[model samples]
Target: MSARTTLRARWQRLAEPTLVRRSVVSVLLAFVLVWGVLLCYIFMTYKHTITNDPGLQKYGDALLVSLQDVTNPAHAAAAIDSTETWTYIRRRQIGIFPGKTLHALSDADGNPVFASHELKTLNLPPRHPEAVGVITEAIAEGTVYRIYTGHNARWALQVFEPKRTDAAFLAYNGRFILPYLLLAMPFVLVPVWLSVRNGLKPLQQLASRIARRNNDDLQPVGFDAQHRELKPLEQSLDTLLARMRQKVERERAFVQDAAHEIRTPLAVITAQAHVMARSQSEAERTQAQAHLEQAIARTSHLAQQLLDLAALDEAQRPTPRDLDVAQWLRAALAQAAPRAMARQIELSLDAPDSLTTRLDLPALESVVHNLLDNAVRYSLAGGTVAVGLRVDDGGTTLQLAVQDDGPGIPAAEQGKVFERFYRGPGHAASSGSHNDAGHATNGSGLGLAIVRQAALRMGGQVRLGQGLGGRGVGFFVEIPLAARRG
Candidate 1:
């Protein structure tokens, strides 16, 4: 597809319930609602008007009586058309009996009345068959007939108003009604538009603000809105901005610190290499070589820290694999065994045979390794570091906790430990005084930060507290349980 066509399609997809659709649907719904109410009002008004019209009801009843009197066989047929008799009735009853016709009846005693032969084509008897049927039914039911019957011989009375001459009355109704409907249409349109515009104002403002934002605009969105519904949206957007700002700031600080750290080690290596070049004694050469090795180790440690940070950032979803949490923790403990031995810390594992948590193995392994590594590094010789696993509520998660019997963190500082490059006072103390060249080292202090990030990516949480015996810090990681393997 052409670029323009593609763009149009994308916009069309996004524009469902657009301004046009909203306005149209709103107006149509308003029209229907108004029309329905008008219909009900007209119906009620017409019923009431008809009921209250004393002249119309009185005249109609008189006309029906005249027609009934004419239908009787006892009143012998005059040579004159019954239409002439109707004239007398109509003038007397305010034109109610305009005119009528007569048909011979089935019963010798009864005659039929109608205005035209067209009406007789319906094959209705002298009286309506339905009316006669009702009288017969009443007699069978042992109920009194409310309709005129018995001596009247079941003659029917049907009334009709002339459509041509009465057109003026209908025209008069429209004359009063049409102008009102037209005038009220604009009034309805204005309010519906205004209410919708008012309702969408905050969203419009939000869109405008977002559209105007540049990459450098990290300021939080202000909440000077008058609407209550908009307040939640404003607060949520501000929260998102605050989080994004913190992430950017952390990344920037990490870069600056990493550069400074790498530069120092390189400076040390360069200075040592220059000294080794000028040295003439065996002792000087040995000292220079040892300094160079320390610089190389520091550079390697910095590189590892950078790698861990990237891994944590990249972690979003876990690969589909059955990860045994207990087994992974055991493997991590075994890897940290040497470090724990050097620190004279006891590595204790308390796990089920095949406890599993749903996660990517590599990312999950990093979480386990980092926590245990930190625990062993900080603990005093002969102190115990324990790792344990248990299932959570709903049987849907595996909770892993690593505890060390070293100096515990103060409650006030527990929250800050998870921040990147933040190290507890206990770890800093033992880091500088250790004996083994590789084992004594502390890299960029991102171990706990990595653990927290990994936990978040795995849909888990990391909490810090005192150890099982309240001796040192406890690092807890909780993850959802894996699916059953077939």
Candidate 2:
């Protein structure tokens, strides 16, 4: 393949739906979602811990003890100025805490003795001392603070630290967690992709087997499907191949039969032409001309029937409509009237005035025409051919029958009469003089075959039996009302 074509094929394959891709995408999404929720929960828990820091209360208690011994208010204020614990608290204002911290000292009446530089500038009112060791949150100057207060009879002390914001927490921690997730992704995804690919191996093998088959080979695939999910696909493909083989065989047989049947009439036509050219008398020329005409008529009839059979083979399902069957039958008889009159044969229909039913028009027409042709052709001069149409008493099926008062087919040969191009013992093309009806007696033998096939296509069946007066043959076709409606 050219580079462009190869690239296009690769892109199409990637765009196609695959189990491996779906599995990998689903796993990756779930992994990221779970990790995100866990990180959020951890961040919230850490914030809660910092808001209630127990170590801040300890520092407050120590500051209160340092001021307890100084009776003079100036001495009390001076003691906090030089306390190492206070100095350590001052250093942490810019050190351990993410934001600033503040400290305050007050007497029992809430007069401020000392305040950190930032806290003193704010000029905030003294907070009422809570129960010793209690922590509370306060908002001032648009900043939230977690405050710890401690008090004795001599003094009240407070410590404050600003609460950290969510953005600051994520910025500090994401650098560590994101790398771990990226490092873990390949380990999780690679094995999942491999497992999905291995599970689909059987389907790939089945496709490869189909691709390797020759065009003429309609045999079933030999690959044994071990997976339960793949068995139905294998069976369906085999069923389709079997049907294709059957259709091919039928077409081959039809072609061979048509070629064989047409050869005899063609040879006769060629021979008759030669005889007419060589004839010396008017009587001889007339006989040669007559023979040539008969051969041509027979060949024409055979060709028409061949076309009809081929068309029936390829026809789709019929579309049925409501039709007055009795009226239709009478019209068919009128069309066949001249042919019947040629042989002095009488055509009659025995039916009700208006028998309406749903039926496939073309299929019904084919069945009627072929059946009438056979009955009229086979009957002797002055004989009667009867056509009957009626619905059964229950009205579920319509029955059509045609019979002739002539030499009937023997019981032994009746079964073979419907085969294509099948002529009985006395009906051969060379024995045209046996019956008074010249071309009528020498049939192409496709009428009954066409009748049976047309009937079958209409979801009906044909039966062979005794004709009128129990002397000649009869063909009965039965079609179901329910099937016709469909």
Kindly list the per-residue Cα lDDT of model 1 for residues 1-486, writing each as its tens digit: 999999999998978676645785778676657655765576567656644653333443554445454544344233123543664576557533223322232223344423444344433323444543232211112222122121233343332222212344444554556677768877877777777777887799898988899987778986577888888888888899998898789789988877876787889899999889999988998999999998898789768867977977973565757666677777778888988788778888887788754567766877887787677766677888888887866787768888877766767667677776654454453542111122323455677777888887777888876685767778888876556331
Clashes of each: 2, 0
Per-candidate TM-score against the hidden true structure: 0.66, 0.63
The superposed Cα distance between candidate 2 and the true structure at residue 435, in angstroms, equals 16
List model 2 lDDT by residue over 165-198, tens digit each. Answer: 6776666565557788888888988988998899
Give the runs in model 1 whose Cα sits over 4 Å from its true position.
1-21, 33-64, 68-183, 198-214, 272-293, 319-321, 339-345, 380-383, 392-397, 405-416, 423-441, 459-486
Tell me the deviation in Å of residue 201 in model 2. 3.2
Alpha-carbon lDDT, every model: 0.63, 0.77
Q: Give the clashing residue pairs of candidate 2, or none.
A: none
lDDT (Cα, 0-100) at 423 in candidate 1: 49
